[model samples]
Target: MKKSLPAIAPGLPLGLLLGLSTAAPRAFAQEAAAPALEAAASLNAGDTAWMLTSTMLVILMVIPGLALFYGGLVRSKNMLSVLAQVFTIFALITVLWAIYGFSLTFGGTGLFYGGFDKLFLAGITPDTLSATLGTIPEYVFVAFQSTFAAITVALIVGAFAERMKFSAVMIFSVLWFTLSYIPMAHMVWGGGLLAEDGALDFAGGTVVHINAAVAGLVGAIMVGKRIGFGKEAMPPHSLTLTMVGASLLWVGWFGFNAGSAGAANGIAGLAFINTILATGAATVAWLVAEGLHKGKASMLGAASGAVAGLVTITPAAGLVGPMGSIAMGVIAGPLCLWGVSGLKRLLKADDVCDVFGIHGVGGILGAILTGVFCAASLGGVEPEGFSMAAQVWVQCKSVLITVVWCAVASFLCFKVADLLVGLRVSEEDERRGLDIAVHGERAYVS
Candidate 1:
């Protein structure tokens, strides 16, 4: 009678009205949450595109880029062998990554090793989004990380190049990739120990460069020297090809650095610019150092410097400022020069392509400097409550961990390979060169 009861509630009892009143807000909340849920599961097309491009670029870095670079540095007789090794390693690692490698790296919640929950890439689909990346499809992330693993294993080939048996190299690569690379990658990048400890390897200072370098060093020592290593002259067969490969590496490295951002955003832009500046600065610095030390600035020195700069900036690619990257580059050139020369001789290990020198020395230096340059005062995008000293200490500890882990694991891997297939070819085979001895191919027909 008061108002004949309003429209829809005309016959509803008091309790029913009360219940409906309460349910209204709950229904509204459910509706509101639906969009958010959809968004959370959605992929950013731009990010996916960039990551796809980045994966391709990194593949370029391995195949022709690293292959040619390493091939040019070896003697003419061994050129085809170097290319074969790099190419084969790339193929091998890519397949392995799709199998257990990806699962053992990014699938678990362990402190040292990721579990096998994702073995065979199970439970993943085109629609699956990365929990960490949030927006990109998990498949893209997997492909991107696979490139990193491939290149890392390929890098070790340069250390024992021209001497190691093909079968031995393959065995060592499989073992080291499973044991050394996977663990280090988990610790640094896959939310394991070092990452938990606030280690600042923005783009794989410890995970990729240092990890590969240490393994390469160990392989060099265990594989022993090439037959005529110390007493002979082993000039690069084609500096021109080396230069071309270096150039390609420089171009592809943008993917290596900026792609780590996982998005086509400001951080990616920062990393791209830093890659250019640091590499350019490092090249000049290397030329100057070479001119001072050897009385000549060589194309080889320039190429080496560029690589050094690239390696040094990798750990700090998005963390440091432009000027800070240049400083890192400048420091990297000379330090890596010494690493290849003084450090190489001191160790008495014949590292054919200076894998330890440029990648190792530069990675350590970049990782340490990343701590310093990451200060907001130094134009870096500082971490929350950042302390340069604390970060630097964390960086040093990470480096120490990587070095020890890689050394021991690499040694064991080499031993296993040696026991299984022998680490070296016969002296006569080595003298004849790996191209003809192992692969039965020639780089040049003439």
Candidate 2:
């Protein structure tokens, strides 16, 4: 807990270098200089308070929310190892972001990445406001985005849990965050190639979910299969705990999607409602698919499907209409279920928690659908451009770039970490389980 707090609440001193103002909308003129907003989005007291709360909510998703979720899924003997990896990775990502990740992604610069104006948060102050959120201090904005960054790296643990070495996880966490995650965030959200071509990623479908997904698949392959893949049972140790954690993730995602709008307003409200509607629809679709695929529907399938829906809607939450969100939920559920149970088995990849199936697959689906449903006519927002053909092209390009980049970069990082500390534990350690071998602790005791 001590290690984690410093990362989320690092007391970056709020000196007088920067000032708080409203987040004014930057006007985008095709092939022209960026138009300065006449007035940035104002920082209302209500907005600031809500954002602060939402920011903390996202942070919670990593600390206890994700830790508990993944911990409960693995065997009791390996729980703390998974938990420690999640906890430690959160802290490491926080420090790196405080140091350089934020600047490289959000600092103003040319295509591909940004310049180093905000190194170590050099000029950030309590008063400095980012153009995106108006008057809230830029430091505050960075703090909120930090949670997203932390959780993305932590999620990779699911792919290689129960086998990976803790020290190796630490090394890859930093490298992937800098080389891969920062560049993708810059391109899709911070004003890179995707944004230049008018791609729509309200939060981080490409930046977070898809990037994590591809990296996860690579890790699963590199770490190789679990000790007894098809031969062993390998069932979730506690479905009850998994369900509880999934519930928290469901509730916490409201902050994840709505907060992306950057303030308390109509757009936030729309995102919140769509989050609920789409998640509900996906839950239904997923359970239905599971019933048809297997002899009976499983509780885990229902929860996992809801997550798939949430991932699919994340990128389009702000731009797409409500009905479009519902449609996305309906489609992504069955697709994700098929990917997890069918394709995963055929491929024989050991993605313990289906990270690529749900997050990566769902994110790609969401990115493309954002173009389809973002029509002013669909998602409650006034549509800017709803060319199915054009937006789909943009969506395809963005997903392709994110997948390829994340895969290649993550593969190299994983290999380097492996060669350094070794990615997986020894055969003796595997038999003993990672909870004891890697972390020297257990999740519970009699």
lDDT of 1 by residue, 217-247 (tens): 9999898898877797889999999999999
**Model 1 poorest 10 in a row by lDDT:** 13-22
Off by over 4 Å in 1: 1-40
lDDT tens readout by residue for model 2, 1-446: 01111121111111000100000112332112212222443445666776788788888778788888888888888888888889999999988998988889888745678769888988887777765556466777888878889999998889888888889999999999988988988776676666666667877788889999899999999999999988979988888877887888888888888877666666677789999989999999999988887878888888798889989998888666688889999999999998897878876789998889999889999988887776555533432333567767878998998999998999999999988998888999999988777767777787
Task: TM-score for candidate 2, please give it.
Answer: 0.91
Output candidate 2 Cα RMSD. Answer: 7.3
Instruction: Count clashes in each candidate, considering only residues at least 3 apart in sequence or on different chains.
Output: 0, 21
> What ranges in model 2 sit over 4 Å off?
1-36, 379-385
lDDT score, candidate 2, position 407: 89
